[model samples]
Target chain A: MITTDLVPPRKGSTMQFGIFSVSDITRDPTTDHTPSEAERIKAAVAIATKAEEVGLDVFAIGEHHNPPFFSSAPTTLLAYIAAQTKNLVLSTATTLITTNDPVRIAEEYAMLQHLAGGRMDLMLGRGNTAPVYPWFGQDIRQSLPLGLENYNLLHRLWREDVVDWEGKFRTPLQGFTSTPRPLDDVPPFVWHGSIRTPEIAEQAAYYGDGFFANHIFWPKEHFMRLIRFYRQRYAHYGHGTEDQAIVGLGGQAFIAKNSQDAYTQFRPYFNEAPVYGHGPRLEDFAEQTPLSVGSPQEVIDKTLTFREHFGDYQRQLWLIDHAGLPLGTVLDQLELLGGEVVPVLRKEMAARRKAGVPDAPTHASRVKDKYGDAEPRQPRPNANRGDNVTGGSPYQDTDEGVRASLPEL
Target chain B: MSDTAPGPAPVRRELRLAVVSAGASDPSSTRMLADRTVAAAGRLAAAEGITLRVDVVELRELAQEITTAMTSQFLGEGLNAAVETLRTADGIVASTPVYKAGPSGLFSAFFQILDNDLLIAKPVVLAATAGTARHALVVDEQMRPVFAYLRTMTMPTSLFASTEDWTDPALSKRIERAARELVLQMDSGFERRVREESWGSYQHSFGSAGGTETGIELDSDLMRLAAGGQA
Candidate 1:
């Protein structure tokens, strides 16, 4: 009989550990009244750079279109961060495919890929607000269709040499190519983000793309069901076994030496969070949602439990900055996560994923192998030109006035 | 009033076309595509006997200022003014190149920083140029939905040209045709506006109190639910 004790310890899992900061220029309730937007933006860059310094694998910045929130362009910020740091993969917490045209999205990201040396990826979503549609001259009724069509176009834009597409929402294209080719000639891996929509999950599965469940607010069971659906669909698509399908998850947590301290420190910030405030009790949220509140060990244990539900997946992104938490507190949380929680979690996950575990998506993995080694083909010698194409002399003049140039012939 | 000075007639209905190029260089493919689209609009306006004011805004030059404006209250005023012009324009031709697998973050950032109500019901023509024949679908995949979400009346014909297409005369003709079709649609909308104006007095007499004919009622709950699901 199979014994429960025989289950291996989770350790050595190569996870793409990331920290996301939603930069909003707000007042520091403690001492400083308010900070300038530039300061907030600068702080975001600092935080991302710090995350890398602290050994985090990835750093994602969010996109927002309103006042107070400073980061409207996550990739732009990522590019700047890319210039400042090395080794850390840059990603977007959210990219609104519904409101932005696919063409511009393609060009900008390709540019970013060149800027970042192919260390970029994105999570596409229909943004969170309705007011944004009219602001962009769009109708919300077409959200799903838009997402579907836009992603379809984006996929073709990346993988193919030419694309011919016609759709209901946007104009038709005959043959188009996005420029500033990606570094290493490999497109960035995409993680389709969703909370409740099984449609997005199915989309991810159908395309063999990674499905990311940003479980910030919901219970594990809800995320499990969605992930299960994606896994099953992924198998149905003939990509691999259910466990082999790539999955990424988003988590939020605050930790202190003790549970009580964690709650006390995080409560004030939780209460004022623009997205999650006034909804649930802090303790209850900790219990029901993915918001782990306690010591580093507890955070590790909670994260390890994710494999039990979703199996060995690809990435895990955490929200360290939310609810206008002060920079000091936020940094403290990151230090705890990076120094303590992540090390243990990495060990545990690696041990658990001992066999039949799919590797996390990477730039090296995505590049076409044949193209990887081939030197760039040089242009053929010009037949029309008797000498140089620029009208320069074809050969060096010899000292002999007897036309020594013909000596070799 | 002097007998020689006739009373000022009602101002002629002027059509404003804002052509925003989200490309880098002045003669970049996106800009070229945008120019062709604006030229089409001008032709339609001339044909319709209406004065068309074309404003070509290159996003590259304004990208940094717009990002700065998104945060600073004072700088935001300038961005808002530009946004206001986009809102009031009769038509817009938005062009960009596909970068990665989606729209450029620069373009996306511009969209991300704009207020959602700015582009409601305005007509938009989407166009993109890329390096290879690939990424032709980015117009539909990345951009159209964004326009749709903004509640803009997007023209159905998007013009996507690759590097080869840019160099080919046949592709240029195709782009011109697509631009002409978009202009035709905008001109038709203009005609509808004129027809509506002729009957406006009688329609206005019967106020909303007499009928339950409310304007578009958006389902915020559904949108929220969708957002949650997508997020």
Candidate 2:
């Protein structure tokens, strides 16, 4: 836990600025044109690459099981995006912790982490879709339990080489080892993303994970109290000072060189988009929440207030590219975002941030924090044994006698 | 009479009565029924030496905000203020127009946004206004169960005033009877005591994101299963 007064303890991740997509395949209401699923998926790739090209810090996508959203397999998509980019840290707006088995999640994301060369992290969320619960062999009534139980199991699987877990939502595992292991013996950082669930905030604080407020839709007052609660709880659990509790926030903005053009261009998309279209007028929503539709200076003025309200947050992500504004327009947005908004924000947030506030987290910083100039652990296997399905440690690094239970079986 | 006459002046305890009127028009019969019920309740509470303060939440005025609440999944400033009024009340007088075999859409919409446990154990006087006497049963059948779902103590003497009943002397008596029941519950302090002694037992929407607090105990065998040893 070494640190400088000015810089965060970790390097290259003082605070992150990025974009998150709902991965909406929306028809452009103004133009009356829609992108095919293939085109939209390709556009998502283009958007992420453009993010890195323009010098943004992170590129996160959402996972949805139903239509009108095309990002069902986020690990695969992020893995693909990871191969194409160099330093842009890719992540998820959320990976569903409720439906998918925790074992599969641990294995899949760990594989992606290794492939990405420690350039990944993810957020966990209980999906909002009710019908989708049953589609994944789950009951919506048990969603709260599913989320908590699954996340607990996932947390243990990464840190412990041999996991003995028993939970209600999934089958009991006596001795299981998730394959590939986390990159350099470090799990990708996790942020618990929630809108208003205090229990989710409590959960994040309990485990000392980051708590992310999806601040785009609701008023800032709602989230301010919630973040305050999380910070207090984090201190209660002995994580750090209330100021040291890692926090990330979501925002929505559409900026142009001129403020009027930004407003005019984003209005139709706001009027017909599925998540919040046709509900409140743009001006009212912007006034109430963190949404800013104006010049980069306007976005800067509004985003600076976030620190004043919530106190030195670790990350700020914008929801910029849903509602089918088309690829060309979205790319132009990334340009303004990287070229204008983020530079000022990084400097201002650093100036506003006090000492001992942890960085948003990256794989390298986490590995450094865990090992600290010590050689990182890369777990080895005794043999290519099929015994991991049965019991005992498949990993050589564990004290559970690697492949000893296997030879007898 | 003005306080100089009395040896020691009596302290007036304020009883908040939330009045929800789901009328769409300015001079609406539904609003008229709600106001009449409030007037009766206020008079009865005053007779028993309690001051009644009625807070009106007109559903017509909140149609757009309700739609915004539906999409955004949180109440705006105006709508949150309205809900906060309902939460602090000792009793409620809910009146709605009968529309196509049930309560009007606006009436149901407003209630839908309230946290289910918000009105728990509070007494309510259910009233409805309609064009024909046939829709009189809508009060007991529709509105009663709606309040029942929130675990409110909905009064047995629900008032349903059709166009004819407005002038018929019978409906006025029914309104008084309903109001008397509400006032009696308030005087007994059933909601007040529960809210005071065991307010933590009442769940909230923010305990989880928009999850129901329908007075149904959420902790179960699943807690052990979900969090394992941690639970």
Candidate 3:
């Protein structure tokens, strides 16, 4: 049976590293073979499971409501993966904070947390796909406002038992309660993912949330400015020092025993990937981005440069599966990464990390902080008091009295 | 080319002027008008003891890159250089030929690729050359609003010349007035200082390919709302 509260104090290395997939089901341009949606879905699960087998820290899946992508329902997939894996933390490349109702996000992710034993975390992103807005009965013009207001509501829902939220985008909630009060009464850690917008950075810092910069195909300089803004704002808000602010970065690489073989094997997939194909040459793309197409040691040399560029980040997630690279190739790449790259990086980063920098947050560390020397609250629902979470209070212990007794503000 | 001798007292920064011309054809009068306006501004700068550096972006040359930028949603290096130059320039001399009773698509598209803050509060001398006087309103009615929306410090006097006005003495006087106003703004460093001092208050553009990061204003309405203040 899956353990419900098995999130032990973070045991392994200082840094948390893993792989995130965009869930694109592309035809292998070199072999002209395409995987069915069913096949792609199964392959993704296998890849995530292999992350645990290889002893990685995290596995994240991106959400897209359109075709050529299969990860529309992230929580469902992650819940299933939760049953399958023992130690790997399941997350999203980003949950669409703009279109998805914050109430639904709070409930669903919290539900996943209970099932996953507090081994769940999610990144929030304003998905750049413009058309997804209207389909969800939202206007693209109000994306920023909707995103901010939704998150504000979502934040309150997880922390407070009886939430009365009145925002511009959604209907007013009167004593509404999000169920399955987070596992161990610990809200999952959130990382705000952004590529270009500084307002998003400001929002992340204002909430004292982690800011993730996905350095997929862009130059390092592009993300550096945004990360710097986030770090400065994080400190400005008194969320510890700038170095203690939570950060995560995304990178991709293909590696082999020999550097030339690694480059040769990945060149075909790089040339025909859907997003970046036909734009620039592979060498140009590699030089401009964090992508490395060389030996495992070379990938380390390139990734270590990230600390030089963006200071002392906490999490590093890579894109190891996409562009129709088959499952075998992907598992091999994972093996090389887990065996070679991450082990050395852990030691190097630990030595260089300064006096007070915080490690990546986990359920255990957060719980320990919240309930030091005392038993943490595990909220059980009071008897269903006839329809309206009657008394408007749903939680068992705190504010056990009705809605009228709930404190204002 | 090593400089062994002591240099003159250094100034805060060199005045940078960018000339953007939107004429489609070679040896077009639109480019000539821009050149004249820049020359007048340069003379005024020298009179005030400011060393000036000039960069010109002929839209005729970058016509394709701007269009590609719209679809690619990214600026190529060539176009990025032009946008960066305008972003950091202390002053601008903009001239365009009127097409179909308005500014040319090539001219407007170039500006479209530039970030909204690329020319924020920079002193600008607006000049235009057209086939007839009937199209002179293109400068005041159309181009004025475009620069206004960008929040640039457009000179009080704008220079508009017809094909025939190229020889008119009135055009020369107008160019002098506009150029003198632009140079006045530059020499006083009014726009530059305002931009630097109030930069944190300006809404930044999306991409980092152009523009600098001025910290966001904590008291701004957007920041207040993002901080959970009431709508």
Q: Which is the leading candidate under lDDT?
A: 2
| Per-model tally of clashing residue pairs | 60, 0, 1
Q: What fnat does each of the candidate structures reach?
A: 0.00, 0.32, 0.26
What DockQ does model 3 achieve? Answer: 0.26
Interface RMSD of 3: 2.9
Off by over 4 Å in 1: A1-13, A29-32, A368-409, B1-231
Q: Estimate the overall C-alpha local distance difference test score of candidate 2.
A: 0.82
lDDT of 3 by residue, B1-231 (tens): 011111233433468788888988888899889777777776666666665677888888877667656654445566777877787778898889898998988888887777777777889888888888999788889999999988889999988989889888988888888888987887787877877688767766555225365544466555666666655
By DockQ, is 2 or 3 better? 2
Q: Give the TM-score of candidate 1.
A: 0.57
Better of 2 and 3 by lDDT: 2
What TM-score did chain B of candidate 1 earn?
0.71
lDDT of 1 at A345: 72
The best-first sequence of candidates by TM-score reads: 2, 3, 1
At residue A383, candidate 3 shows an lDDT of 82
Candidate 3 structure quality by residue, lDDT tens digits, A1-409: 1112222223435679899999999988788999999999999899999988877899999999999999999999999999999889999998999999998999999999999998889999988888999999998888877887788888888898888768888988877778878888889999999887777788889889899999876657778888988999899999988888899999998989988898789889987887776555567567767887887778888888899999998899999898989988999999988777777677667667888888888887788878987888988777865653545666657675545343344
Question: Regarding lDDT, does 1 or 2 come out ahead?
Answer: 2
